[model samples]
Target chain A: MTVAIDRATGKRRGDRTPRPGLGRRLKNGYQRHWYAYAMIAPVVIVLGVLVLYPLAYGFYLTLTDADSLNSARTIGVNEIEATYKFVGLDNYADILWGETAYDRFWSHFLWTVVWTAACVTLHYCIGLGLALLLNQKLRGRTFYRLILVLPWAVPTFVTVFGWRFMLADSGIINSALEALHLPAPQWLEDTFWQRFAAIMVNTWCGVPFMMVSLLGGLQSIDSSLYEAAEMDGASAWQRFRHVTLPGLRAVSSTVVLLGVIWTFNQFAIIFLLFGNTAPDAQILVTWAYQLGFGQQPREFAQSAAYGILLLAVLIVFTSFYRRWLNRDEQQLAI
Target chain B: MTTTTVTPAAGPAAPDAAPTATGPRRRRGRGAALASHGVLTVASLIALFPIAWLVFLSLGPDKDDYLHPGRIWSKMTFENYSFVLSETNFWHWLQSSLVVSLGTTVIGVMVAATTGYAVSRMRFPGYRKLMWVLLLTQMFPIAVLIVPMYQILSELRLIDSYLGLVLVYCSTAVPYCAWLLKGYFDTIPFEIDEAGRVDGLSPFGTFFRLILPLARPGLAVAAFYSFITAFGEVAFASTFLLSDTKYTFAVGLQSFVSEHDAQRNLMAATAVLIAIPVSAFFYLVQRNLVTGLTAGGTKG
Candidate 1:
């Protein structure tokens, strides 16, 4: 088959003559690969318009003093008009240093980190624990797995809203607390409790993904490794530490990384829980959206700056993560 | 593929170890297994309790009954459901959600299928780079894009329109779906393409006739994912659509919650109604979903 294709290509080359025009060569190349280009054109066009353009425009917006009300206003120069002024790092400066009404950037930034770390750590521990339990030879494991994974399958908005109601002052949780003769703290009123509740809600929403993914990872481990370790008289804890942890390392890292990004950018649950009112519980994402659209003045540029900072943080984190993963992959290969 | 690495070792060791392993470990294993089961049962209940609570609240008599907590299950009623369905624009929201979600799914699946095929099968310049670009897009926070997207849509006069929302959803859905479909495509043997070529089919013809038929599972997985993403999306939908009648379920549900914060029964009823279709769809395609998602993660 290779020889036949080579011979056909050779004949086509011979038929094209010693020096084909550049246009002819271009046309031939197009003819050869037009179908491939055609297949990919819609995806490229749509993504370019909706994703790439917006991304570039967002960066541009970060450098200007655009707002919701005056977003359409422009200063006329000669024949052209510009809706926004070139503020040149003013938004970033205002958020990072200058005193403004939206000066909660630092606090929100810190909380975003704390929120992500707590959620990811709890999610990993709970998920891995559940997955390991499920991995054991138990009857009706499928039913248990399905029930555990139900949190993931349900729409997140529904679950988050349900949780809000459940944690309400007059709701089931406080009622249960009363039944137990225990005090139920305000879940969403106090700042500390609100942050704690947000983490809990996020953990509840995230654990299923981690559980399912880690379960897959656990299933893929060689049971013979366990037997080998057993033969060596290794304790169960030691075997799990040495064998199971290493086996799950790759999957755990991926799950944690993805979880970090998702939790950091989580908007709906927090938004629904606090509405447009909770300043104490706001993360960078909600803060950015509130700045851009939720508020009266609607500081578009400042919001874009917040977004740019988030993007930078994610990029830095991802690069470091990829480096660590690559090192692990190399070690595994050896 | 990694599963193959385990089988060879496990096959010989299992039978050899079974008899010897059972005697000593059985006693200890029983106790540990019981403990594990107990913990798992509690965990599962904790995981499911909120959803179960929602179901009860939705069924309970009225908002006051829900606030009373202990009075739940005292009397069952369907008045909340009837009220949500009849009194408000719940049906209108449902219809809007269906149209937007279906539109996103159809367009997303079509784009993913073709792009997946091209990237997997064709020898194109920068194809590898393109794949990485798609992956990177998944890491982007949607908040970053919302400002520019709002501006772009407003300029095009697509704000408050289904087409604009669908387009944004398609863009968001495309990157992951394309990568997933591409992973699926990679699993299919190239011999199928060779066979199609020998049978005198063009590249497009082979893709549409042979490759696509074999890749139906991939398409189904992508379609279902796209549908769910669009269906549950709140951020963009809330930002883009202004009118109550044009609101998707997620946005509409939020409005309902804000307007009736004290009315837990009605809120729960609406949440249950909104969740039923997605849960049903998820249950139907769960097997494919797990495999597809894991494959995309591990392989892509």
Candidate 2:
């Protein structure tokens, strides 16, 4: 540490003044920022121990061929050291392109994309619609909002179970369908139904938040803009497109980013609703989870690789999205 | 200036209406109001159906009565609720869940406030980097962290323990809370901090005695968020809490579903029991939640 500090000291800029002593410089920085450092110490420590360290450890685990069976264990001090061998890049390779595993990986990735896209789009549209409706001088607006936001207020696992109940083969939804003389398909059994059920429940669970968020966005828009648009003889659609959309730009971007990330990694709905069901219905996050913990002979290395890949995909997507948002700056030579 | 800077976008959030509560908005035709109401009512029905169905199912006498809806209508009873209360480990799960959730909320909020205030008020050498890290951490989610989390938890002999779960929940909640509270703290005036310093108060005194009390709304939002997040978490709870005795509601509820038998009635009862308190808790804090959320969200 002292050597590193000494190295830092060797570089002097063109300010032809006497440089402070190394100890004084060190003391200065500490005196200047100690409060800030002290304040953040708990956060830094907690995040380090729980997240960063594990992330580093998870990367290392991915380099080895570890599984529940072969990995180290301690049964009351009868310590069994890990027998798993270092097989660098093998787990990643197997997960990405090994024939049987590749099929699973690619299919799950595709579904995850579809699921995330479908759910976020639906949530945003429906939420925006609901927000727009409630933003008016309509009767019982509060009443309607309170009821609509119920799903979000309830715990996710509970609501997932609620959907599971209603979507079951002989559950009320099917029973209602049959009574109305509509054909009742096997919701719990069929692959299409499984995927549909997952998306439907997630959308139902998600839309309330989007609605509330967008509603907040709607409220925040200056009413004077609407009046100005009206004075200019802009139609409702025209006013919405020009005024409302721009006004909502900030809230919309953040929520959409959040929505994408949340929907992409949605686990409890998939896991609790369909416990180790059809592989075709599984998304990548849940698939990785099932690999690591849900199934017997838990594939720790493979699962960690899947997780790293998922993180990589999200980072790539976010960076691209950021670039797209900043494209106007480039175009205008800002 | 801070208020306008936030554009602090929270009001009685409209479901599908404008906040143009005066002037020409009230002059909309009766037909338009009816149409808006019609759409909202239908949407509300769709939103409420599954939950309402769960509550109804919970009252049925037999577990299989859901499959035969006609039987449930004929003989509705609270037997399932009784069974879930008396015959199972429901109380234990509920207690453990509350312990972990409360612990996470207390620790997460306390830890985050300092970080939040630091980032909001200070420009230390690594401040920008810390903010960036907090932002990036959201994308590196539960899936990526689960395996290593398991390994670390076990090493500390923390698996199946409430403290273990609380610590794990903190990793997910604290960073986000820090990010959020920074936005909130930004809304508070710098004059107050200066005033605090004038009174010969240390930075900590100024923060805890002055800024914190004033930042109640933000702290409430942060606390509520932390509580809900830790309460509803499943992947970690199911994996780390190895024994049934340590199971949270999430872990315990799943056992009923995967049992290869009909326990939907009891599951429904438990679901209803859990949802009431949580939903009520949500109701208490939702206004602040929305306000704090949009304050940060609008800045994005």
Candidate 3:
């Protein structure tokens, strides 16, 4: 009746019942939304104090030249005020274009690109192949899955250590290569092999997640689609290309984006595998980390700048990737 | 969408139609099956060999046996294990890891569960923005907050405290679990929520008494995720926890590097110990992991 009257009465509430007062509406809103507000209060408070606060503080740090020697410090009963002056865009400028910064940033940036692309390509290909094989009615499928997923099942720190041991200068891998008279490169020592080792170890750790997710995507595709394709005389390759690829687009898109961002910012593998010594092999995230924590007289502003730049790169990439994904959806619709 | 769990078994049965492809194709299917098995065997071996080698290395009595590489098979012993157990801060590290992990899991899952339930059941103000915010949180790397977090934690005198570590980890784990659990909650039918409201139950009561019990699997997945994340986290734990007793396995293992070559054997033994329980838990929850992740992924 109130809905009917409101519709008939020029969008006002029923004339017989006036709208609540401002205070009353406030009370009503609270009553209606308090449960939701209460439920979210814990997370809101925690994220607010911990995450958002630091995030804001980090942004502030990026605008100044804060460092260990200059930043304000509290020593016992004495206080030292921060003298690091504001330097907007200078840290970014230095890292992005300054002469010495060019070599440091660009070299690390190039390797990071190569590392991400190689690892993601390997992960997707190996994961998809294994997934396709497992999608068949094969014997010992569960056994194969259990074994293949072992690297991911183990903690990354532990598996990386395992890889470190195996790839050591006189480790088993080189020993095996030596016995066979093949080239046994210094995996941990040499630059090329160190980068290769990092990517290989990361791929080993990353593939299981991709495989499992893609397997789920494969499982969810209707058998009727396959039958229809078979009826149309599609070849095995045709069916895979047309039906399987399109069907996996949803899962693959998300996973690949995640793979790129993850590989770009991957800290544990590089850190655990090479520690801080392999400056040449360090990714941008680890390099930023080293600046802030690893070095003496920590350069907080520069570290924060590097972090902010990485975040910007990811945000821009994600938005573009999302737009591209949506366009693909539109093209499919057309 | 929720039934992806049951589809894996039904999915592979499509191969029954593959053999009858006509055009002189063999109905035997032996070649394809054999090739699949062969490839899988090779892959499985590739995956398993590294872990197996670690276990083997952990048994060496001499610290430098790994360097020599040939004497390990002849002289394997549990000396490294006993040594790591008795001659180090293994128990304290284990306690710290478990405490921090469990604390993060408990706090992370509880907060996220309520938020998940709220966002699932209600369209309160900022509901749409909440989802976007949760997604954005994932994009933030640890580098963004480490220095400021150090300052904040130190200001509050929480640098060497488990409370500080758990709080920092909660920042990482909560949003992720919330996204995952929200997706899980969506899979549960809304009619149950309605029925609880009709029975004179308040929203909180309905959520607790009805929805929470049914959401056990989702809650378990969230718990496992949070636990594993806090367990293996390196950056925050390494930075904040300065003292050895406060160190998790990640920081503790890092300290082993400067202790020289004998610690390699000890590190192997310790690595095995660290990996075992976490891996066991992973195997237990791997099935739900796919479901939880994709649920949050596709929907969010």
Candidate 4:
């Protein structure tokens, strides 16, 4: 084989080889890895043009008085020759501190946080509960698992639309409540009910992901630990708290972090459910979409500012999450 | 390894060796099993009820049945499905969705496979940083890119075009697909590459001819994921494709409700139609989907 011949001659050649110049060695390394560069070139180029350039242009647009009507014309023309006036953080200032608009920003921010927190908390609880239940040996567990996971398999647009129909004032849920002589809250009209419905629908859509993730984590817990805990006269709650909780910590944290990001930025459920017209239930994402696309004289720059702010917040959270994950991996390794 | 032992031990029918176990313990086990089954049944019902109701509404005779939940099955018919299929532009939207989704899948998988191979197997400067950049792309909100993506697409005269939509979808899908493929490629041994090199194959040739076949499962996972993503995406597709006939099923379905009021039956039928293919695809690849998703989350 050529490989055997090369190996045989390579060692002999290495023994008498003279050191190469820096340029020669660098060239050799480049030659050896040229294919790697070629392989990744397309991805780098496409992402650069599509993702990175737009990202930079978006940041630029944030600094200008761009709108839906003007953004295309402004950015379409040469960047340097664009007619849109640069506002230099005025959009940010207006959204953050301009008295009337400030309330909108803060309220949306608060709802975004609340929405993300409630959804992630409910998702984790419901999902972990389901995982725990399903972990027990039971008849038709596989079928139950499959059925429970169907929500996730269904497209989110469909699920949200379905939930919207179900939660309508005259829909099945209210009808069922009325049948039982219970008060039926107006789900879409009232702010509190609207937010509740949004979170409930999101949890319905999200819990399967959590359940499957936690199920995997639960399955990975060694059974011997449970046996040992039982031998020590640990109660069921104690075993769960001491053993199961600890075992699931890493996976739970990851799931929660991801859940926070997704829920914070979730647009479809709220958008399709309320048609992006429910002001009382607006989170940051839909609010941004409304600013940019929902109304005439759309505030593209302001919405871009909102997006940048959301990105900044997420970056901070993600860095902390990455740190926690790294620490968890280290602890596991040790 | 532990699953084999743990399953039977926790099962209702304990082994004969446990005959000395107390009767109360056995009864308690049975009760616990019954309780679990009860909970599972309720949870499954809750999870599936909305979809079942949607299907029922889709099959119901008219919009009036939607208001009266009790009458869901009173007058069932297949007219709604027929109406959506024949009266609406549903088939047109379906074609657009399929073409865009398949195009994205093909391109997304090809680029991801090659890029993943490079990142996984080759020793190159900036490869680690490239991987991090790819991961970061996954974290960035799609909303942030909406304005710029719109501008870029418009500039390229691709705003209403399938090619433009496919490109945007590929941009979103490629990062995750590449990461998934790279994780898969890492599992493959390097000795195969060395052996291919010994056989006088170039790096690209080895990757294409030798490594790609071995990574079919990973490629399948990536392709399915990309297809589902492109198929179900509404935010970008809705924005970029402004024409009604050009709309993907997601946008088209959304328009059915937004544009036309009191079309719940037809809307539900359309939703069911949109969901069927995705669900079937999911069924075929559910196992790989779980592994791919968890792997991306935990590892990437």
Candidate 5:
């Protein structure tokens, strides 16, 4: 009713107004754009509250001793006198050096890098291979493609735990190995094998994305180029190298960047398989979870320190990607 | 939009590069091609082995029979399925998941649609900056946000609630949705809205009554993505929603296999049940997904 009222008032004024000058046109533009502004307001507000605030809060929380159980307290002036009162660099140092903190922080950090690298590389190799194979003309390609994508389509917890179960002592893998007169690797009991299992699970979850992306890229490639390469006396390898690979450059780069970020931050495969109980396999994210949720004497400051460190690494990666993208564009322009 | 044309290799000018056209030679080529395809087909099966193993385990003769599928079989049974269905709280948890996923999709689409429309069609100050900031948000690791988000949600008394999970899910989904939707909306002609305006409809009516109908495919894709994402996301659900009754199907299903006791067959059955609906959902929306993802690149 109020909206109608304002409309009627504006309509009455519309009949009596002399045509607006340049200044008034500018003003009218602002007035007309208001609805658009109003529509976008909620999105901006929600992002600010949920994303921006937490990011800022994460940075601030690093300087405080606000443990989950502690209820956000000050560490006092005497503690400050001892250089331990909400000190900024101390938490960073604690995470950097195993000195004032929880155990195996560095080990987890190293594992995180290795885990991400393995996941990304395996996903790329298998995914690109699948993309190339499926791109070829084949009978029952649709069915085969659908079956391959099943691992990715299923939810994470189900498949991650499913793999975990398969790796169990009396599980299918062990059973199959025993039947074949081969020794079953103690998949969960060992550190390196467990990490391999984690990577396998992560790769299982991740490859479909890369495959789909590469498929899209391959389909977009101009087939005439392949024919042209063949006419130039190029073998299959040369044609694929010169045509298909170059054709896929942009999509492939984007795939690698996205895969890196996703695998780097992947938590479920490791957390569900190993949890905090595995002293060796914990990543930064799982380590943070342990500090906050896994233990009683939770160290919020140290967790925040780890969180901040992870953010810095990711930010650096993002900027590097942006620069890489710009360079690619420039080269293409040339 | 640069269309660089490469000259064809096997065209009339380069006829010498062709393989021998003799029948026997062609037969051998076909045989080799078939062999290569056979190898790849086997490889594909091996790649899909885990899923096959899952299906077999679910339908195994008994819980122990799964450990020895090649050996003397006990018998096939629907007992695992019945055990997962009738004896467990899985159905209830599945219902919770459906509600939370559907709710997040609805809210996310609504918000992203309106925002995307505005950014695409309207002249607004700082709009570009806002878009960039939203993209920048994607750079932050979800792991980095975990602790602070937990604290904030805890403060709001939203922990262990559908509302918290939905909010978090929608927040993460909006940036990509909005980006994609904005790109989609830009491809729409502005003349349609102008025509609606001249016909005496309000700007709101122009969008709701005219533009939205045209953007239906885009909206469907966005909604489908949001739903699948909310449906699959387990980290936030497991972390935030602690109560057993409130737990989503994914998390609840995880509880089937604990530290000491694990019903591998029963868990497989439950997992199969979970996969059915999600797979069905994917199948239903499969066509739209390919179109949606490619739309961002092929269109302006």
Candidate 6:
């Protein structure tokens, strides 16, 4: 590519003689795109080193017994021939059906799906409502926007810890409920309430982004559409169903997809809230963390295998979404 | 500016017809609408209650004896803030956080802006392929990279250093920042760059003088986001920066939970202190943050 580019530059400069041939033409073509290539070099080099190499290295380490004890044992006979050494596909199989692995593959998969869906759905509902309310020419709009954005603005850990404290046995929410003569539900103790609190906190942090995004989307929908629907004597529900929903479809879909990916990979809330207390609170990523870093001789390959599985699932969903969007685009073009 | 009279597009000449739904009873519909909005506002306040509680708790007295369980007035004091600011390594950690987050923002935006411009406006081989690769990279859990990163940073003798944290944070930020900036760049016409190239300036000069200036708002948005991400990042910093002096404010606040003394008030005060800087920065750059966040979601 380099030689071709140089030759093309030479031809473009008219410094070369006739009969420069196909090679020269190819080089000239490359030269035309040289600056474009130059512009992209930093991206390739930076991403290649930091992202691609590490990702590949992560997979490589998965094939070897690169546990904590094998730090310096990169290449050796006994370690290689050991029963635990260099067993290709065994780690993956172990994660899939290993007795010791707390996460049954299918259950973790189901939990991930359920968790993602519940969080995103609740966030969207609350977010869309706020966007609708704020989109109005109302009083104290900026103040409300600032207030609503706080949950997302604060650091993830601080918000998680705050929720943990509030949900404690004798914390603020319980205290407030007691003062109000209302029953304080066991938020962090019961299995159902633990999940509920996690979802509530996660929704608090997640909803603001969607609200802001939908607010921007709402601004773009030509008010004339709504006005036209009104002139036709269409009800508010009918107008929203036809005009607002279609207008919000694109942004809402993007929000849902990104929300799923982020929520699935969330570690801070569940980790800090449960903190090794409830074994079932260990999601896929947190489980990976405990197995990889919580032990004396860490199982790096098993952790990597788990991460790889998560990545595979995400890729499948993303591609499925992309295909779905592409079909929509094609239909629109038609 | 004086108000100009423009004709209504298609609604009722007066706005009253739309607000009043097609009910025989106008009072009931209006009342229901008001009630629903009131309910929504109340629900939103409930959602926002934790931060409100955090603020009040920070201002509350130290969690010591004379623990009056019921009276809220008795808990109001400023001692926790004074103690948190004076006793702990809060100042040093705050300074470290500023350095690390600013470094990540500056480097991340500088790299992403140029590369995003190239990707969005310039055409070359493997351009589409590069975007696909970058997008796919986002799915992988970055925690998986921490151990290898630890090994590499350790070998480089950069353990517990701001330089090490900055580099890792900036690297993780590059993909998303670049992708968003590319979306922004796509909005700017290629003719701007073409005009620059036709004027005989080098591509780099054109980018700096022409494109970068025009993309300032977008760049501001990207930088704010990158800054916030780095500022709030805890996982890698906690794992990598082992020394106490090297801790960012995020982990420093966790120190209040010692084995012996659990100063809930002081910790809340510290959390409030850290949150103020973050929230202030967000408020300052909110316009850009909103734009950067909603980058690819909406068309117009």
Every candidate's DockQ is: 0.40, 0.40, 0.39, 0.40, 0.31, 0.29
Candidates ranked, most accurate by TM-score first: 3, 2, 1, 4, 6, 5
Q: In model 6, how large is the Cα lDDT of residue A133?
A: 70
Tens digits of per-residue lDDT, candidate 4, A74-165, equal: 34555543357888989888888897875679988888888988999999988988888888766798999999999989999888778877
lDDT of 4 at A285: 81
Off by over 4 Å in 2: A1-30, A75-77, A329-334, B1-28
Write down the worst ten-residue block by lDDT for model 3 chain A: A1-10
Docking class of 1: acceptable
- Model 6, A1-334: lDDT tens digits are 0111111223432542233424534665565468778777777788888777777777766676667665533243433322436778777877777885545455656666778889989888888878877776555667778788878888887877677667887787787899899988887777667777788788888888888888887887888887787667565555667788788876777677778788888877777677656555556776676667756787777777777787888888888877776678669769
Better of 3 and 4 by lDDT: 3
lDDT of 5 by residue, B1-300 (tens): 211112222121111112345565355446545654775687567667777677777887455655576652456677889887888887789888988999998888887788888866665677657766765665566666777888788767798899888888877888767766876776676678778977988778888999899999899888888888788776678788888888897688777667216766788888888888888778777656755754443331
lDDT of each: 0.79, 0.81, 0.82, 0.79, 0.71, 0.70
User: For residues A24-55, could you state the per-residue lDDT of candidate 5 as single tens digits?
Assistant: 34766766668888878878887887788887
Cα-based TM-score, every candidate: 0.88, 0.90, 0.90, 0.88, 0.84, 0.86
Categorize the docking of model 2: acceptable
Tens-digit lDDT track for model 3 on B104-147?
A: 99988988989988876665677767766776678787789888
* Preferred candidate (TM-score higher): 3 or 4: 3
Could you give candidate 6's per-residue lDDT for residues B1-300 as a string of tens digits?
211112112222122223434444354445444644675578669667888777776766756321333454675778878887898778888889889999999888887777887766554678668777767765666556765666567557677899989988866788777877876776676667667867987778888899889988888888888888888776677777877766887777666665327777787888888888787777787767776666633321
- Give me the TM-scores of chain B across the candidates: 0.89, 0.89, 0.90, 0.88, 0.83, 0.85
TM-score between predicted and true chain B, model 1: 0.89
Off by over 4 Å in 3: A1-34, A74-79, B1-28, B260-262
| Candidate that scores best on lDDT | 3
Pairs of residues at least 3 apart in sequence or in different chains that clash in candidate 6: A4-A27, A8-A27, A8-A28
- CA lDDT, candidate 6, residue A255: 78
